[model samples]
Target: MAAQPGGRRGPARGPSKGAAGGQARGQVRRSWLGGVRDAIDGLVRSSPARFAILVFATLVLITTALLSLPLARAGAGTGGTPLYDAFFTAVSTICVTGLTTVDMATHWSPFGNTIIFIGMNVGGMGVLTLASILGLVISRRLGLRAKLMAASDTNPSRVHAGPVSERQAVRLGEVGGLLVTVAVSTLSIEAVIMLGMVPSVMAKGHDFGLSLWYSAYYAVSAFTNTGFNPNPLGPAEFFDDYWFQSLMMLAVFLGSLGFPVIFALLRTWRSPRRWSVHVKLTLTTTIVLWIAGAMTFLVLEYNNPKTYGSFGFVKTFYEAFFMSTMTRSGGFSTIDMADLYGSSLLVTDMLMFVGGGSASTAGGIKVTTLAVLFLAAYAEARGAPAMEAFGRRIPRDILRLAVSVVLWGATIVAVSTVIIAQITKSALDFVLFDVISAFATCGLSTGLTESLPPEGKYVMAATMFMGRVGTVTLAAALAAAQKRQLFRRPEERPIVG
Candidate 1:
């Protein structure tokens, strides 16, 4: 040892060099991690859409990896699940889009099924919403940016430039309560649905334990609008079980209504006048679509012989109603979708394309979007300057956003259908049906999904991802990439359609 500057004696030189080197490495690692954390936080604060997409994509990747494991597959020594199937299933599960390339009942092990169950619940909770909830739990409160993001989950327009109106589906100050509502509502609703279905499942010849498992699976699937069946026979086993079908329909309807609407209804149940315009529009439009779709189905398929024709009037009506409900992102079916008339398929396509409510587990352009567009058309025909719904004049910007969402959704569906159609060369009708199903995340299929080529599956998987992440959110994320201008270009009318 030797004397060192400002020290009595030198620490052993060899040990000192190693310790200094270790300290430098640790500092570098800490700095790197800190940089990564800052980047993530910056993303979360800057654009909630991109952050939500990143989180969802990461979740899908993790789910895919789990499903790829050998243990995730059924049958001893069957080897690891195929990448295409695992990846597709991962997207389907995490998106709560139940389209599957493989048989749900025979393909996955218990571990795999558990992963799907958990993933569906997580995915059913909107991505931005889950992130905000986690942030609130970790930090004991949400920051301004976190609240803004959560508000965006409830109202996509909240993230737009300019001050948001106090009138919102879920306001900034109420974001914390909204997050709590999301968690509490999801768990409570699912539990109730699960309990309700257990006895019906037990009556279907299963023991209490098996019935409980099936009931729990169906509860999560139904509420999430996931459409997965644990049984070998699928929905066919319950085609005549009115109680099971009714409960399932109830769960699907509630789940499709979106959390904000649920929050609104719960808060304003006593006073109908206190209900927000969004609540009014979503409920009215959804009910109208449900009934209209049922009638259309009954008309189109009543004489098809293979479908509704075999059943009597009551059975036909019930089945028509069930199918109509399922088409709105519910994904369950009691009969073969391929057996429907072409006209019925076209009608189903229209219904599924409209999908459920905004910020809900179900996807598509969203019911609010359809309502806004329809109102816009109605107002235009009346030569009105603004769209009005439930006595509230909808702003032009909201109309613009609604149009953008529908256009974006239609474009995505068209592109996906063409790509998948080119890949498989299947009949155009079935191909279109399944493509719309994937794009809407509605999960209905005309036997096209299971038989799609690998490339087609990939396209459908991407479609499902886009549909679940939302057209509006994706558009917002894209728009956020551009720098904001201090001035606007002069508006000009181009041409009439």
Candidate 2:
């Protein structure tokens, strides 16, 4: 959930710099574990998507094992950590879905919290993506077969085996180096956000160490969109300060924009035109949703005393904006969602279903999916031959993929809602919100999470796991080995939607 080299034939080479950390370079031989890892590596190189799913399953198992330990659970609640509870918590945290059966602050020890932190940090990107990035960083290369499987060069690729041109070497370097920049950028932003949020804790008179820990935990959580607040007292404690609120909002905003967008923008700081079309579509859709969702919340919750009504205009506006931002898989809420108006809940459900951008810490159908769906509709209505957005033509195959993702996501959410409603005896709307939150990996709950039964919790864990891995990825895995058709079938017109 992890870094550099120095080379050769220089000066008097004082005992060699690579060995300066006390361990000799290449002193340790590969273990039996490395053989197991190599087998897994070969599997990953063979089928990145399928292997990525396997890796996530394996991580969840590892996380569950750690959580089931006696110390991972508190000595307080329910006497002992139930296997289901530990398993559910592991899934939620590893999926970066904040649904929890026990109160995180009360139930988990520092060791447990650290485990959750590691999970969120690694799970911010899909497991396969993380593995690919790590493979590049540690090995300084990715397999050529893996490269061809990738939809973007941002996904790592292997260095060629034979003689290479200078320009090709530079390109290869950038491909591998992108992972480093992504890692560095994530840590740096989180650090700044932690600092920005620190003074708020100090103002509350919390001890320095506790404040630092809280600040760090939340910075990681917020940026990863896990939204698992570590404070025992909840938002009423340290987060009462407006400055901290703004910083947290900004952190969530950046995190949900997707890593590739951030990397491109960071690397090419000033050039708007140089940004990729994917980046442009993501940013534009994100911005539009943020503003529109904020406005919708303000309009709907304006008079609801339980939410923004009591705060008055200026404060309410900010709160609304924050809530709206949080809705795009931000997962944190300043007000009681249970108390919000039905209309507000409906709006929130929609936003949670929409989720954040692709390749982001956020979940849901993804803003790009929505953009593609809408653009395809526009193209169809105009009788145009292609779907175009921001002057780039979107392939018909992409449109089909987008529709499949949305439909699959919606189907999962709908089924889960019914199951949860039956188990929890919650109303349909409330259950729908919870289910959609789980499905989108948004983690926002309407006070129903903790009240759900063990079975209910398991249902959510399954939904979160699938959502985090992606409905499309899961569907593809399940529908493995697409058989090639030997003969073309006749096309038939079907009834319209």
What C-alpha lDDT, on a 0 to 100 scale, does residue 256 get in candidate 2?
88
lDDT score of residue 337 within candidate 1: 94
Per-residue lDDT tens digits for candidate 1, residues 87-165, read 9999999999899999988899999999998999999998778777765665565898788888888887775543476
| Best candidate, lDDT | 1
- Model 1 alpha-carbon drift over 4 Å, by segment: 1-37, 137-140, 160-163, 480-491
Error of 1 at 216 (Å): 0.3
Where is the poorest 10-residue window by lDDT in model 1? Answer: 6-15
Candidate 2 overall Cα lDDT vs. reference?
Answer: 0.77
Give a tens-digit lDDT track for model 2, residues 303-350. 887877777698878888999999998888877789988888999999
Error of 2 at 145 (Å): 3.5
Residue pair clashes in candidate 1: none
Reference-based lDDT, each prediction: 0.88, 0.77
